[model samples]
Target: MSQLNKNNLLPLESPKVLWAVAISFLCIWFYMLGARTLVPTDEGRYAEMAREMLATGDWITLRLNGIKYFEKPPLQNWMNALTFAAFGLGDWQARLWTGLCGLIGVFSVAYTGRRLFGARTGTIAAIVLGSSFYWAGMGHVNSLDMGLSGMLAITMCGLLLGQDESASPAARRNAMLICWAGMALATMSKGLIGFVLPGAVLVIYTLVTRDWRLWARLYFGRGLILFFAITAPWFILIALRNPEHPHFFFIHEHFQRFTSDVHHRSGVWYYFFPFLILGIVPWIGLLVQGMWTGVKEQQKGFKPLLMLLIWAVFFFFFFSISHSKLPGYILPIFPALALMIAVYLESAKPNALKLAAGLLGLLGVVGLFSVNKIAHMGKDAIDIPLYANAAPWIAAASAIALAGALVAWFFAGREKVGKDIAILSLAFGGFLAGQVAFLGHNPFGQYIAGTAHVAAINAELTSPTTPIYAVGRYEQALPFYLQRTVTLVEFPDEMEFGLQQQPELWIPTRAGFVKKWLAHQANHEHAVAIVRTDIFEEFQKQHVPMRVIGQDPRRVIIATPVPSQ
Candidate 1:
């Protein structure tokens, strides 16, 4: 119950109180996690992939829409498949792996901060990380990035713990082993960057700090053995089973993905700068101040702060130079930044907390006013009315966050840092609640996810084996919802390689599809195809025999008429 002084430094809360608070926050985090729906392109795609893996009983080789998918390693998919097995497939189950990894990342940061700094800093670090917009949002979503980020955090923390001179040789060895294992799991989660980023950061840190003695204590011999042991079996098994796995996964997925615009995800060099600034929302100013303070503060043997700075900067530039860019790519750097900010926040003045709170409140007001703009931004993809309908939920969430920030500001003015941190935590919870509300509204998913239409198709099917086709485009969510793979007709977007491997399973063009459809109808076989709305009309003009089964604004599902007896 001790209040913070004017300088805003406060003693650590008792262990019992801290644990209770952590447990309570975690419960709230999990409760709000299930409120959102699984979205397309990533969430639905990954979930369906895991579901397919579970259904096919083939663990070694991964597949998406019944095609070999080698774009990512199988660690996350393995975890998700297991989750689906333990619990029934649903929104929360699909997201469980990412969410769990994020929670682990939070605790790992807390433990590492406590060991390196103090209990107070550790506690603050957890709060900062668990509450950040990027960390919180990505944690609840199904994505490879969060799992990779979380594993890398553990790797970095393990390295820090192991390299401490004060720790016993035995403890350091064990910690280094943990570091190796962390890297192995991280690699399994997201391929090369897991190893590349951590290795690069360590090398740079050692060269700059001139810590030549540090490598001796790293226990490299045993560590490398552990790393290879944990990471090699899957890669070897996958390669042996599928001859093309190594070339595609290691070369095309990693090398080509980075150096060329093969994925067509090109962005300007400063693309991530805005995302990074906005991602840590309401904490940007504090982050800048915290980083500056970290640079100035000197530590004796090894400089954890400098190493963290190197980690953040290196990741930023490393991905910035890549042809492909995404907001989640920079997620791994957040925990380091959170720890840096926690260190500064522990000793910051009350006025600093007040200023941050005020800024957060201002952001809330802006969010309230920007609903229409946000709704219109997605007009090309979704019905604007859907976004308008979802706006109130977002507004309510923003209001709650705004209120919490104001209360935190009041507490800060009273020199009560603990109360201020507590309020800010609630504010972040509100932000996440808003995100869930918006996602749950299913505005975007309604257009992209073929679940409802697939359901309609399923209801009308006379047999489970009825042939289905996707013409000219692939709906990422359709296979998952239908619980069956559809034959491709003239579309090979990301599935080009897979289609090449199984040419017998696809129709090469609209003409080929028409021929196949007539053959199926002549044989009295029921066949259905989902096509773009425009393509459906074109087919209708061509006088192709079709009966519309289901239609959405973006797509239409039609079936071959049953031949009269």
Candidate 2:
């Protein structure tokens, strides 16, 4: 613990240097938020939701593509809608909420680490979390996971900071309020799991440590008030407006999705382990030693480190056992892991840091050499060109990481520079490398965004209100790009619940779509339909009236054929 007292070894000792690095990283961070195109099904789905919310001015009942959507809560949509309202709709604006949430997670963890441990641990924890692949990568994306994770990070940190025996009574009360409020917003961000996961962790922590005194400090009466104040109104309003939201959202979205493979997202028990390792990235070498140290260092009274362990390990197992699984499901655990890693790095042997840096450098070299293989990752011809276009940016990212790793290795060996510069160099490298790779992915993402077909669809539009049908398929990003909702024809994927609520919002049968198309054709009305290539072929075989407006190998955009002269 005395090693943490040596401020010289910390990266934050030099205020000017730290400020320069912080400002530069933030610039790149915010810049990249708008730089990348939104990809499906998360990015486009969320963005379009916000766009519709802004358009319709309906904050209570959530809608995706003008149909009722209640798979998750509306906190993120509210933030995103607010972003669109303030900034007008754009790529950066769509992602602003997520970007801010990721930043908030990083800074909050840093502050918690500083308060619980020292300034050194605080700065290092920020570096580890901010540079980690999953956290950093998803921060730029507009997704519900990052928003939920950010609020959870606050809850975890607030609980730890408030429960610390050294905290004054007044400080404890304030921090606990923040913790409760975080849980409320977190619940609004995702679902019940926000508070439920943390509640379970706290219970497990108490039972194992026998810290019976810890429960007294929770301020439950006040906390619950704060929680409901932030969370209850929206739930009440939505339930009141929709009447059916409670059953589908609470029962179907939460319980059914977790207990069964209702969403069809089930994975094996070890689903999150690989992602956890990859999420650790350049810090992987420090993980074991960090967790071991966290376990070993136990103090009288409160056990913050033990609580962190329970938080991470419990959530890992909880999600792994669930029938529903996703790469982002485990995101909330990263902040706790970041704090543990920071403590280990602060007093770690120079050789260990060097080895970690060297391994990252090796990964960079391998990435640089193997980047050409990215072109082959495409499943079809349309994707091959996009992958090829992204290869150069990925190569550049690898080079940047390699250079930073080498610099970190050199500084790790120097007693004077110590771990401060080495940690900063490695973190900066990893963060920048990720941003570059993300920026490079825009070409591929544009196709997924369905932006390429937007112009042709617009060109075929004889009227601004011309009907655009999604036949047996839904291009998630297309409606967002076109800034208008498309009528669903015979396919309801994630929108099944939403469509069930408003059956008139979609056409449920091919015969119904044919009938509608012939009606439009008879009226000499121009209409556009976006369909999969196979579906297009089927429609062609049926002699449906259509003319190709635009197409890729994956999707064909067709318009009503001109009436016979």
Candidate 3:
């Protein structure tokens, strides 16, 4: 009912309200995180790596499916391993690091916005960051990108806070130190991009804004020492222990992976465009306006808004030029964009708010109408019936989002801007949580993780050390669910380097795998091998002595046939 002034602009102004919101976010994050089974390639691989580290007591060297995996740094794995140690292994524990990082990133953006702009801006920024589709989705999964993006947000926030000339000397010093520590942790989370992207942003910002004096405030000598202290030990230890760790991690993972397309993940220049558009979702209209506003808002001394615009732009273009690209690569830019939009929303006219809400409502309506098509689109890999079962939940969530947007639009039209923003934020957050809890996990569990088949295999295996082979394919979730490493039989897709390091652990060809299967049959050992259904049929036609033990549409687990009595 009250018109928002500078003092009363923030919707949840009381400390109690803030704490309540923070706790609510935490509950949603952890709940959604635990509700989902780990997806393959990223979630399963990372979780398996952490599991291996905890089991083997090897914190430095990371492994996937018992093979040396140096594609990324070990910070995320280390955090996950520590979580597993504290909480015991499960989906929640595996995702704890990313979830925590997401929470921290939200707070960091809020704090940064409050300090630079106003309290209202800060609260809005937190809501936007927390409710964003990509940010929230990635946070619930075990991915390195969320952690890296979170740390980078801290790095950017710290730098922005420290750059303020009016800040006390001690506060500035502490902020710079935070910046350095954030950079270190970020580097540990992913690799060089932690330092590279932020460093590039600072350079470009300085060059464009002509703020050379900001360099003096960086506390370079002490900062560099602190950074090395936090980041160097793991690299040094891993290199000393594994002779090939440094080259593969530093050169192959970082340099070669960036400069060349050795990973075969090449994409066109605009590969990230769709992700950027859809990632922000309901806020897309506001984000575009915010970007324009951010660019136009130049002020005397330090320009925080302009700096954020440059940060987002530099991050976008940096990844755009890279030889390889993934949707998660642009995550770090979302917080910056959120802050900009928050600032815009703070002083925005009610009409503008209404327009944005109406558009969001329309988008939700469109999604609801297209739910069937969206669910059926993945039928090639997923069971259509099982996947389509999530359509109702998705439609319900979309309807809730639409209802909230319409209500917010009403509030905005009635000049209740703060209520409008609050309602809109709550709606989006609910939609995100509902989608994650109801829709995101089950399809992935059915298709990617093969949870039923893995559970069946685990049930069938009498011994923890039962020999299981992955023939012609590697299911990333198998080792994690079974709580044991699978022997690779003619399957070295991404584990070629690890296979090279320990050649004896893998059968090099399909023929070699058949020979091993015959040997197990001759010895009367109860051995199982998971292979594609087509491959299993082919092997069966070859008169391989195996019986189906467990199966899914995509894969089958076959064991050595019991001898005729």
How would the candidate models be sorted by TM-score, starting from the highest? 2, 3, 1
lDDT of each: 0.81, 0.88, 0.82
RMSD of 1: 2.8
Tens-place lDDT digits, model 2, residues 1-565: 3354466444466777779978998998889888877899899999999999999989999998899988899999999999888889888999999999999999998999999999878988998999998999989888999999999999999999889899899999899988999999899999999899999999999899898998999999999999998999989998889899999988998999989999899998888989998787778778888777658876888988888888999999999999999899999999999999998887888887887788789879988988889867877778778888888888998998899899989888766465677888888888888888888888878877778888899887777799999998888888888888999998897899888868999999988998999999999999999988898999889998889988887689988889889
Compared with the true structure, what per-residue lDDT tens digits does model 3 show for residues 118-160? 8878888888888877888888778899999999999999999
Candidate 3 clash pair list: none
Q: Which candidate is the best by TM-score?
A: 2
Top-down lDDT ranking = 2, 3, 1
Model number with the top lDDT: 2
Query: What are the models' TM-scores?
Result: 0.93, 0.97, 0.95
Please list all clashing residue pairs in model 1, or write none if there are none.
none
lDDT of 1 by residue, 135-193 (tens): 88889889899999999999988998898778888988888888888999999999988
Candidate with the larger lDDT of 1 and 2? 2
Looking at candidate 2, what is the lDDT of residue 209?
A: 88
**In model 3, how large is the Cα lDDT of residue 519?**
92
